[model samples]
Target: MIQEKRSKRGALLGLAASILVLVLVIVLENTLAPTSQLFVVLKKGAVYSLVAVSMNLVNGFTGLFSLGQAGFMLLGAYTYAILTVPVSAKDTVYYLFGGSAVKFSLPDLFGGVDTPTGLILGVLLAIILGGCVAAFFAWLIGLPVLRLKSDYLAIATLGFAEIIRAIFQWQALGPITNGANMITQIPTFNNFNITDESGKVVFRLSAFFPMLIMIICVALIVMLINSSYGRAFKAIREDEIAAEAMGINLAKHKMLSFVISSFFSGVGGALFAMFANNAQAKVYTSTMTYEILLIVVIGGIGSISGSVLSTFLYVACSEWWLRGLDMGSFLGIKLGLFRNGFRMVVFSVVIMIVVLFFRQGIMGNKEITDLLKPRKKTKEVAK
Candidate 1:
């Protein structure tokens, strides 16, 4: 009993220490290093970090082979864009349907509807509501589909994603989704404040603000995964039949994982939308889903820390390095043949290589903590 208590205390201390470190890093980045190169990396890396973390919940912990993450993301993105963008912008015209002039109006219940508070509240509400709706769909789909084996599950999820794309492409949902026409003129979340001409902020979405929220989400998920429910999820992943034999409810756990995963995906999607300035809806293709899956696979399936690390690397490569790659400067020889798709080709090759050689991926199901076991001391010093 004493040993068990000590272990529990140690775990609590470790968690607290981790959180303190994260807080300190965030504070330092925002206050002393906002314009530094590292801060730029963190800012761009945030989106994929959210994606990888959420993907880890479903694909890593729950052992689900879902490929519909892009679809759910698109849902959250479009929902957030529609809710947050000012209705008076010309881009709003493209989002309208039924040949009617769409007027921007906020519900009276939210005090001072014209103010920034009302807009922010509406955006947040939309994100949560959209996430709930997506979770419901995830549950609905998981009930029938999670019964299948690996390949079948992948195919089914992929088909579901394609179906979502088709629905978004349909003109029927135009009033809400705006079909294929690009939604534009979205006010950035950072720009959504009452600012003076000199831009001394009345309100601003500070760089640290989103990071704080992301940290909260990460903490919540880590707590969930450490709970009894998380143990059941692990059991299922190890062996479904054995988990069932142990009196664990298979269907319940599967649905729960799917719902939770979808919920987080939606939240990440909303953040992406806000970050991207409310870009219009497009048919979510396989590329987006595959990219996220690749991140999870490369990071190490079922390892949250690995996922987070790899996501930062992946986004950095894509956003900063890949885009800035100058093909002409290689080996004192111009290789201008490489075009815009070069990075994607390289990314695919990397995935294939990782799968072929390092099938377990970067951390191989072990978290960063697992790699840091204390060293045993030798008695030779006494001599």
Candidate 2:
């Protein structure tokens, strides 16, 4: 009973702390300009974090090493970009075609209200549709690929992602996908900020919107991981033979996880497109999948908090904070090695060092609660 009380208190404290941080972020959003570089990195981190968490769901939790994330993201990005673009802007944006084949925006369902509410609803619906489309693709691909195991599965998924990129780039699909060109004018999260009569800005609709979505998605993953189905997935990950002996339907659980992961990845892709302010087939590349996988591993496979923490770190290194290393001069010295892509080299080395030395990553297969708890949850469960 004492332990249970402590657990309850810990949970309550965690919840209160989470709410406080969220409130602080909102306060900053209203005070800070949406275009602030810090917010830019934060927003970018939110999108990548969402994608990484989705990837972690299948790769980390399910023991699936699938590499089809880029493909699903590409599909989702294209779907959202195409569907959310204004009908009036389509013709101009798609100069290659007379206009976009779809010729409508989901937000126009309200007959183009032009209000903040209308924009929000429209973009949200488009993102949902994009995720559905990506899920559909996953359903098709998972049928055969999920049957494969180990590295073979990775190769197959990677191949399929390339196939998707190629298809999107094909000239025949140019009318809808804009071919090799980037699609622009789709409503973005930044477009959702609210302001007062004095134009002082009242609310940041999307400043916190993407992160909220990511948090909600990550929470659902936590719920699933704590459920009976999640246990079965872990069992399968441990030993397929033993899992089969236990009478768990391996194929069914794998398929379910794959589909769910793909859905969120698609949603993440839509968010990515919005964050980028444009979508292009070339943007969603194999490197992206590798980066996300690297992030999952660095955060510790099956560790959500690790993924979240590593995301900010990864974004800071790749996009902002570590950019100083990539320049021709650093700390008042000019170096030949510190030119252009040198930051990535240093970043890669750091990742290699972590993997070589730390091994279990920043958090292993452990949740943050495991640390907060007086005892390991898994040990308690086993007992």
Candidate 3:
């Protein structure tokens, strides 16, 4: 009972802290310039946070070394783009194919495209649908690929991702996928902003939009990780033989983990499309998988909190903070070594250093709440 109370208290505190941070984010969004660097970093960071955490769900928590995240994300991005493109714009977007194969957009089906309610409902449903499509594919692929172990499994998934990418680019699928062409005109993060009758911006919720989604999704994943199913996953991660000996169904749990991870990864892909304002088959490649894997490694394989923190830090450094290095200087110091692409070199070295010194990552198997918990007090004896 005492332990349960502590758990409850810690949860409450965490919830309260999250709310406060969100409120602050809202205030800052309104106060900052629309073109501020913070928005750029926040938008991309939020998207990567979801993807990284989703990858960690399987690779970290489930001890599965799958590398098909990019493929699943590609499914999600295309699914979202194909479903959410406005009906009127379909012809223009797919003009090369004489118009899109699909007849209606989700927004148009649910409500008129102009209505705020319809737009929100349509986008949310499309994103969720994207995840569903990814999850379904995960189920299909997991049946065969999950039987493989370690590096072999990784190679198989990687191959699956490459195959998906190639298929999406085939000329035969041009009507549906645009066939090597980028899918554009999809609704984006800024679409969530409120505008006046005169077309002037009123409220800025663009940053809040992705952030809210990330929080909700991450919270759901955390809840799942704390449940009995999660414990079973950890057991399999620790030792498949031991888990099987304990009567745990290895296949069932492994499939569940793979599906869940791919689901969120798909949603993340949808968000990535939103962030980039377009989806191209070529964008989801092996390099993307390696990038996400790098993040999972740098953040620590089993720590969600670490993933979240490291994503923001990674985005800020690569996209915003270190941008000056590309221009020949950073922090008012111009060095001969500082030039285009120099930032990445520095970033890579820093990552190598972190990996070398802290192999378990920033948090290892711990959550943010673990750090927030107050240290227990020890009684002192007095004369």
lDDT of 1 by residue, 97-128 (tens): 64313345232224333455665566567667
Give the C-alpha miss distance for residue 142 in model 3, angstroms: 0.4
Worst 10 residues of 1 by lDDT: 374-383
Q: Which segments of candidate 3 are over 4 A away from where they belong?
A: 375-383
Please give the RMSD of candidate 3 to the true structure: 4.6
Residue lDDT tens for model 2, 64-99: 889999999998899999998888898888998778
RMSD of each: 5.8, 4.2, 4.6
Winning candidate number (lDDT): 3
Tell me the spans in candidate 1 whose CA falls farther than 4 Å from its real position: 1-41, 95-116, 185-187, 192-206, 330-339, 373-383
Better of 1 and 3 by TM-score: 3
Which residue pairs in candidate 1 have backbone atoms (N, alpha carbon, C) closer than 3 angstroms, thus clashing? none
Give TM per candidate. Answer: 0.82, 0.91, 0.96
177, model 3: CA deviation in Å?
Answer: 0.4
Residue pairs in clash, model 3: none
Worst window of 10 by summed lDDT in candidate 2: 374-383
